[model samples]
Every structure is written in structure tokens, then in C-alpha cells.
Target: MSINLSSFTPYDLRAKLGEQLNEEVAQAIGYAYAKVTKAKSVCVGGDIRLSSESLKNALAIGLSQAGCRVIDLGLTGTEEMYFATVHYKLDGGIQVTASHNPKNYNGMKFVAKNATPIGRENGLEEIRVLAENILNNYQTSLTNQNLGPIEKHSCLEHYIKHLFTFIDLTKLRPMRLLMNAGNGAAGHVIDAIEQHFQNHDIPIDLIKINNHPDGNFPKGVPNPLLHDCREETSHAVIDHQCDLGIAWDGDFDRCFFFDSKGLFIEGYFIVGLLAEAFLSHDPKQTILHDPRLTWNTIDLVKEAGGKAFPSKTGHAFIKNDMRQRDAVYGGEMSAHHYFRDFFYCDSGMVPWLLVIELLSTKQQNLHNLLKGRIALFPNPGEINFIIEEKEKAIAEVENFFRDQDEKAINIEYFDGLNVEFKNWRFNLRCSNTEALVRLNIETRADPQLLEDKLTLLKCLLNKWIKK
Candidate 1:
């Protein structure tokens, strides 16, 4: 009997079929072979998950089956995969990762030559269809001709050297720094960085936490956005009297920062600061920013003689926009930073490096430098609401505040519902990857008003969810 695989959503497929494909390494190999049949080479990398190795094997088998040469970059992050794709000038690449999802889950991210992402508009949908067909058939050809050769390559040292080329460590000022890798794939790279500094005789105090790579995530999930997740890094910074603290997600492709005072630096402020930094070198350079938090970013970009372009939130959209505009830098409130020098790819490593350069060059403490800008947009951070009926809740919220003083408010529906009052604004967006809804509110300068609005929104959400 032929099953209707098309009926299953990506998440559903993950839940139902993720475990059945024990030999998925072969499937990935086959898919790569089938897609890049005419290509000269393909590069591969994976996140720090226990299942990743098995999946990589299955993928290698499938690639070999297609008769294409493969360069296996063992145990690396997504950005590293992109770097290998560009560095080798390979035909394409793939990274085995679910990206910040729980441990058991695993998936793949595909990229083309020059590290261009493959999305629905480009090639992801087609790839997904092909993968689905292979899953449905349940039969992979195990012929010798289908098997391709695998070559192991290590790029850790080369990647670190390449990263340093963009920012000169020699010019850096002495400061105490805290780094937390959350036991993902960032340890080796961080270690390499420390070695580089030590070897060069650079003067800086470094504090490390959970820097070892472990798939079990003994401390907690690698995500640093959650309040609970920031505890370890925050405590480390305070204990060490570090100038700054940085934490990365599971893949280490995105990094979050805290100042010396142990206060979480909002990603919005980083976006502006980085935009300003880039514009200093190239005036009026195009900068891409997500729409969630734009007022402050726009002001800073314009003040720095740079142009700010707003794009939908997501790596695919940001990358596409960055390429089209040749944006020098792009940032999202979620802490993802994209650099043009990094093949227009997002990297958790690059953000901290840039911040370090800025701190050293300006001879300013992290908090004092970012304090004024962060104060402009006092945000409640992001709050998630679990609702049975998402659409209904969204509509009710929209109707409740639509006409209640139009003169003092502005409303927009780009990605979700955004209501702007004279001094405060709030965004209500449904999670693209989950069933819950997220609300982010910020005031022009009032903390009390922000709290009140957040409370009212929660009450309305509770009312809608109960109904």
C-alpha cells in the first residue's frame, strides 16, 4: 500500500518517521548523489548530537551511491559547513542539525555553491519532496555503483584563522571575558581561539563555562534566550569580574551577550551597535534588520549614515535580502547576526568578535557603551502564550485594540499584529515553528507602562485560550 506522505507536515514527519530511518545516512548520501550528479564535490558537517554521527553515515552512503565525491567535515556547526562550501568552492553542502531543538531531534540544512541557502523559493521544497518519496518507498538501492567515496577533512584551525583575518586581535585592549558554549559544538573553536590569543601573547583574562562538547546537555538546553538558561553564564561573569559574557546555542551559529554587570544585552541593541560599527568603515552601507524591533535600529543606522532595510525574520529571508542589497551586516532580535564577509551567513562567533573589536577600539566598558541605546527601547523581552485556537486569539486581540484611539496608535500586520501607541508598541506573533503565540512589548521610556501592557495582553490571551 502506498502511503500519503504529503499529508504529513515537516514537524509531524519528524515525530512519526524520524526513528524508522536508521540508515538515513545512506538516504542523505543518495540524495546528495542524486542532486549533485554533475557536481565535482560536496561538503558536509553536523551539529553536536549523538544521533548526528549515525545520520552522517547514512548520508555519506547515499552520497557515495550517487557517485559524487564527499568531503566530510566531522563534528562542526552550520556556519562551518557554509565556510567549507565557499572555501573549497564545492558544488553544494549540507549540515546535519535540528538547530536548537531538543536532543533527540535531528534534521538537515542545505546550501548551494557560494554558501547560498536553499529555501522553498530556491530548492528546499523540491529536496523535501525527494526525501519524502525516499522515505515512503522504504527501499534504498544498496548497489556498489551507488556508493561514493568519503574523505575526512578538519577545518577547525583554518576556520579560526579565517575568522581572525576580519578583526585584528593585535589591536585589542586587555579585558576579562567570559564564554559559555553550553556543551554544544563551540568548545573546540573557543579553545582554538584561546590558544591563538595565548600563543600571540595577547593580554586578556578568559573565563569558561560548560565549554566541553557533550550531546546529553547535562546543564540544560544550549539556548541562551531563556531566562533560566542564562543563569550559568551570568553567574560565571559575576564571579570572574568579566568584562563581557557570551553564550551560544546548540550549533553555536548564534550568540547572546551579557555585560560585566551581569545584565542581558538585548539583541536589538547589538543589532544597532553592529550596524554602527559596519557603517564606520563603509558609510551608507545597507543593513538588514528584522521587523520585530526596528525603531531604535533604524535610528541608529540612519544616525551612522547607513541605510536600514527591514526584512521578515528568518535566516533565509535575511540572507536573501542581504545578498540583494549587499548589506554589510544583518541582525535579528533573536540574536542571529549575519556578516557579508562570512559569505552572508549567520555566525555566533562573528558577533562576539565584532563586539570585542568595538569594545577595545573605543576603550569603553560593554554596559556603559550600550546603556544609552538600550534605554531607548525598554522591552519586556519575548513572552510565549499557549493557546488552543491561535487564529481566534490573534483576531480577538486585533479587534480589541484596533480603533481604541487611532490618533495615538499605529497598527501593522506584516508578520503578525503590531500595535504602536504614542510611547509604547507591542507585537503579537504566532510562532512559526510551534503552536504557541509570542508577544513582545516595549515602551518609549516607561517600564511601568510596558509591564501594564504586558499584563493586559496576558489577561486577554488567557481569556481567548479559555474560550
Candidate 2:
């Protein structure tokens, strides 16, 4: 009945369903979350994963046992939980979703009041301790907890309306776009948006594929960031003559974009594009970005009369940093974009709506909007290596660069080892959830330097991964 507490990573709880995650574990986590946060009102939801409903029901039972009024959101994406928590002014919310993980895996993402994350750094550890105690020894500090009522409510209409607020609907252009849901939780959202566009007389055409919620993941996990997973979206863009292409993962918290030419635009460049879009609308404000790839974002943010700050790379760090700096926007190269107005939470639906509005206002395609920025700041894309001693490998590479480059201008240690020179720079960091070291190299208008630096890093990290 007790599950492995090791499943609680620094960010969220995720692992193989049965061995590391189960109904008992979910209930304990829910009970512990209610106790630790003292959240009297909470919302619970889950994705289309086969196990998610059961896990969510157990979790809600625990919350109800703790006397917390539970709003059950049935089947929804991760962002819906976030929005529900903030929109309804609940004390906490939990979503049973594994995001882009394989079908065999499932997990939970938590948010407190205002949609702030609950993680190891904050209250996840306490939750883990309490949950483990309750699950294994049947112990509790407080006795005779009051049971509260559980209500089934759907916040879909309100959530869909909230998404349109990010862009002006009147300015939306008449263009064809491809939407690939990969048979995840995103299909219903796309369908709803399309129906809204039709009713409102918005002239955009929507082409949908894999637009059904299926636990089977017939198309394989819905992660368009992978090279092979992108084929369907890209080919569909051309086949449908779409002006742009869009795709989402299992939970649809993050979205990927493809240009009209069926070329996959790097999330790095898209970050810059989104920053530009926000600053253009607001004139001036702070923007947060990850150090994995920075030059383009910095250039665009500065040019758009905004200050760009680098934050530690994960969602927890980015959200905290965005609040600290009061940033209007924050983006990571991994396709996560957080908004200031949206309770500082990331949404897959928001970024695309803004982009389409941008295209309509600017009277250009996605490629034209990106080509110049892409050329100005060229990167070979992120290269990842599976290394055993990743920390040691990072230290060695950092020392090598420190010793070699006497003129390294801006060496940042916020999230990773980023050494910046005048023309070229690179960031090498260990992934928190994997045995991999991610390397990112970017050059300022120098393709040759980018290639050379990439080759050098590939050769250097080659030995570390070989073992």
C-alpha cells in the first residue's frame, strides 16, 4: 500500500504508476498537502491517463477527509488546475498529470494560492514526510479531522474565455493553422477554440489531427520537441497549406510551433519572439529567460525597451523569479512560457494566440518574423549527452573554459555554467531528472564560430558519455 517516497523530486512527484505511484500514495499526498498547507478549499483534476482518474479520486478523498471543500475538475489539462485555483481563489490545487511522459508513467503537479508551486524547496518535503507516515504507520498528529463536501464543476468555459484576453480578437487575421493534439488532453481545447472562432466570425481556419483524448498515446507521447515526433505537425502544415503549425504534449502545458515552410523553429528564437510581442504591447517591462540560450532573448528584449533577467531553468525557479522581478513575461528554450497576468503560470494556449495576433498585426508569416533574429543569434541547438559523473564533467569543462578564455565577459552561475565571450558562448548544465548533461552554444552573427564551438564541446563531452 505504501509507495516509494523517492518519487518526490525537487520539482514534482512522478514515477512508474504501480511500483512508485498508487491510490494509497495519492491519498497520503493529498492528506499531507491539506495538513501542511492548511488549505481549506482545494481543486483537483487529472489528464486522460488511464490511472489519473483513480489517483485523482483518491487524492480528493484525502482532501475531503481533511475537511477541505474539494472542487473536482474531472478531466482537464494542467493549466486548467492552475487557472481554477487562481480564478476560484482556492487555497490549493493539484493536477494528476505526467506532462510529456510515456503512457506507463503518471505524476502530480501542485500549486498553492495564487498558483505558486509546492516543491522540495517549499513544502513538498513536509508533505512527503507526513504522507509516508500516514501510509506506512497509519499515524497522524491531529485526530478526528472533519470531512468536507466534494463538488463536480467544469471551469472549461471560463478558462477558454480567459485565454482570449491575451490577444485582441478583432485584429486576428484570416489564416489557416494546423493543430496537432497528439491524442492528448489538448484536443478538446483546440476544438472549443475553433468553435468559438466560428461563432465569433473570426476568420482563421483550424486543421486538427490526433485531436482526441486517448490514454493509449497512439502517436507516441506527444512530445514535439523530439526530432521524430515533429514530422506529423510539419508535414501537416504543408499538406494543409497552413500558415503556421502548433502541437502540444500530454498535458498541453507547453506548446511547440512550426513555421509555414514546415521548419521547426527553435524555442530559443520563439522566446525572443514572445518577448518582443509582449514588450511591443506594453512598451516596457521586465522579462525572464533561462540561460540555456540567452543572446537572442537579450537582444530582442533590450531592443524592445525591456530589461531581460536570467533565472534558474525550471518552472519553479522561473515562476519565483518572474514574481521577484515583476516580469511581464518569462520564457525558456524548452517551450514553456509564463505570463504575468495569468497568475504567473505557464499555458500552452496563450503563446499561440499572441503569436497569431502578432502575425495578423504585422501582416507577416512566422518565418519572416523569425529569420533575421535567427541569423543574428545563431545556435547549433541544444546537444545532450548521457554522462555518469555529470557534475564532475561540468566542473572540468567549466574550469577548462575559465582557464582558456581570459576575456570571458559575463560568466553566469544562476542555473548552470554559462561562459560568455564577445562572439560565442556556451552553457553546460546537468539535467535535474536525468543522467544527462545539456550543452547549448550560441554565437553572435558567426555561424563558423557556432559550428567550431559545438564540435569542440561534442568532442570534449564525448568521453564522459562513453562510460
Candidate 3:
């Protein structure tokens, strides 16, 4: 009985589930249950998508079929799922979310016991293979199992309280702040935090934009990385004369920051700030950073008496590296901040909290505190080039630059082609899941030179593409 793989597309399954059976979700759950054979119980959670409930129901059925008990924490973020894995002493956990993907898109994220991320190199590939096999088989013994007892545990309150423990509110000064949830799961989290502030008699003015959790997303996708999406958040801060602005992606797993002047602070600087913050308390601590942005981070971490290790850019990689290195903190230039205390997973909440604390303690403006580092690492942000020949284009650039005085710098091919000079460095790497190459370049304290080098790189890349 060969099952047609083409017939089991995620979209088709989504539609079929909407009509009659949730076979895709059942496969996911069955796969999870089979993976965690030793687990007596598993914690389950999901994002704010409408289909999450149906998918979760199917998943719960699969878990029960495998003789594993299930605990449901409905409408929670990915971080909360990680927290539940440890909080309830569950053997494993799954978060049904597409994260920052569009409203129509949905997927599942999984973790082993102790909140260990299961990515491609880890166990995600195995899970995917098993799930696909289960979906294709469809002839498994169907036991008329009774619905497992579901106990509702509201971890939101405890999650919020845990966030506050990482920062000192008493030292936070009264200031105007702008927050944008971008119509994602962050609305509930932000509202909960605000309620806590009010309850504690903290006098802070909050200006909010798109704080409501509307899945329709009248603005667009909740990704603040796009310039168009960030405009509203930037405007809110400037218009309200707010001291700072913060925006979260769809699931609120990553957050972006804006200073008092409505300047979009690069995630690199935020990483530096977080590294310094963590190092202040735990000197000589190991810090994990993505390979994309290295110079500034390495310098900052070293100056703060911390060892900086570069990991491949992604949540799973950072989480794995953090666990291996026992790093106190990890950060990516895309604004995902990971904390060892927070299950070694990225959190949108911690970065802003630490930034607020830094401002309050230093009594300095955000821009001023980061001015020197910003000058040192004048980045052109990240530019994506869609090409038919990604590898060829990368090689062309490497060859063109390889012969330009080797004695002045070093070239490393860890993740991609990284060319490091005395005062400048750049990395050009193809995206893992997209048909494009991403370019990130930085120089030592000269904006003009940075722009010039970026312009040259783009022209050079264009020439390679044409060839």
C-alpha cells in the first residue's frame, strides 16, 4: 500500500482538515509521541492561528494513541512551550506555530526534554521523515481510544512574573515608550506586562500600535525587518515623543528596538549591549553569537571579559551552542536573544528588558550609549540578492577579492565566504530556505568607507550575476 507523497502537501492537508479529517496534525503528533518513547507526559502549546486548535486536537489524539499523557497550554508562545517543558517536568513539548510566517502559513516546532531544540542536525529531520511516513501510510491500526483528560494550566501569569524577575523595575525611570505587537500573539503578552506595571504603581507612559491580536494583520506580515512594516513603529515613537520603540514579529519570539529619536537600532548593537549587561553580572561568561556579525560582538564580549563564540545563524543553532558552551546569553543580529536561564531559547521579552535596565542604570540615552560601537561597526544592514546561481555568484565574489593583498587580512569559509581585513569585514552567505544570497558588511568607524565598500560589493555582485 504505497501512499502518494504528492497528495499529502501541507496546504492540501490544511484544506482537507478544514473539511473532514486532520490527518496531517495526527501524523505530527504521532511522530512526536514515537520520538519521545521514554516520556510519560508531554506539554503542548500553540500560536494565535485559528487552525491551531484543530491541529492540537489531532495531535493530542496521536499522543494518547502512543500511551503518552498530554498537558495542554492553549494560545501560548514558543518560549512558553519551552518553559512548560521544564516547569511541569514534561518529557517533551511541541509548539504549533509558523512563527513570523504569513497568516495562511502554519507549522510545528518541537523540543526534546529539558527544552533542547530539535532541528535538522538534531531530531527535526527524523520527526519530519516519520511524520511524512505516517501520513503516507494512513493504514495504521486505529484504536477507538477515549479522549485523554486535558487539564488547563494558565502559565501566562507565571511566565510574566518570571520575565519581571530578570529585570529590576524599581530602578526603571518613568519614561514614554512605544510598543507594537503587529497584530500577533504579543498583544496578550504586552497587555499582561502592562497590567503588571499598573499593579505595581510603575509610572510609565506607553504608546501602542497594532497591539490587538488580529490574525488578519491589516498592515501586512508582522516582520519588522521589512522597511515598510517598521515605518509605523518608528513613526509611533517619533510622533508620541516616546523615549523608545519596540516591535515584535508574529509570534513575538523576536523584537526590534528604536531609540528616543526613532532610529532603528541594529540588532548587532543590541547584541553588544546584552553581552555587556550579562557580563556585568557574570564576568568571563561565554556568549554565543551568530557568525554573520562578528567584529563588533567579538570586541565587545572580549572587552567585557567574556568569551565570544560564533554559531551558525538560527535559533536552533544558537540554542545548541548555548547548551554546549553553557553560555549565559546568545544573540543574533536579527534581534533574537537567547538566555540560558530561559530554557536556552530565544525570547523577544528579555532584550528589551535588559535595554531598559541599561538605560535606567546608566541614565544615558540609548543612542549615546551605543554611539561608539555603532561608529565602529558601520553596517549596511543585510541585503538580499536573488540569483539563479547562488554558489557561482558567491565563488565569483570570493575569487575577485581573494587576490587583493592577502597579507592585509584573512579569509574564512565557515558558514560562507567571510573576508576579514584590518578594519573591515563582510560575509556573503546563501539563505538556507530561500533562493537568495545575503550580504552583511561592516567597517571600523568610517560611514563613508562602509557605504563605498557596500556600493562596490553590490556592483561587483551584479557583474558576477550578469556573467
Worst 10 residues of 2 by lDDT: 136-145
Which segments of model 2 are wrong by more than 4 Å? 1-3, 141-145
List clash counts for every candidate, in order: 13, 0, 0
Model 2 per-residue lDDT tens digits across residues 339-359? 998988999999999999999
Candidates 1 and 2: which is better by TM-score?
2
TM-score of each: 0.93, 0.97, 0.91
- Full-model lDDT for every candidate: 0.79, 0.90, 0.78
For candidate 3, write residues 1-467 as lDDT tens digits. 54332222211121223322344545454544545344567777877776677777667667766666788888887788888888888878877767676666666677778888766565555554555556556554435355345566868888898899889999888877899988878888888888998999987777788888776778887888888788888888989999889999877889999988888998988998999999999888999888787888899889988899989887777788898999999999998899988989889998888888788989988978988888878897889887768899989888878767544377778778898888778999987655788999998888888888898899977764544
Candidate 1 residues lying further than 4 Å off, grouped into runs, are 1-17, 20-22, 25-33, 36-40, 138-146
**Candidate 1 root-mean-square deviation in Å:** 2.7
Q: What's the ranking of the predictions by lDDT, best on top?
A: 2, 1, 3
Error of 3 at 378 (Å): 0.4
lDDT of 1: 0.79
Q: What is the lDDT of residue 406 in candidate 3?
A: 47
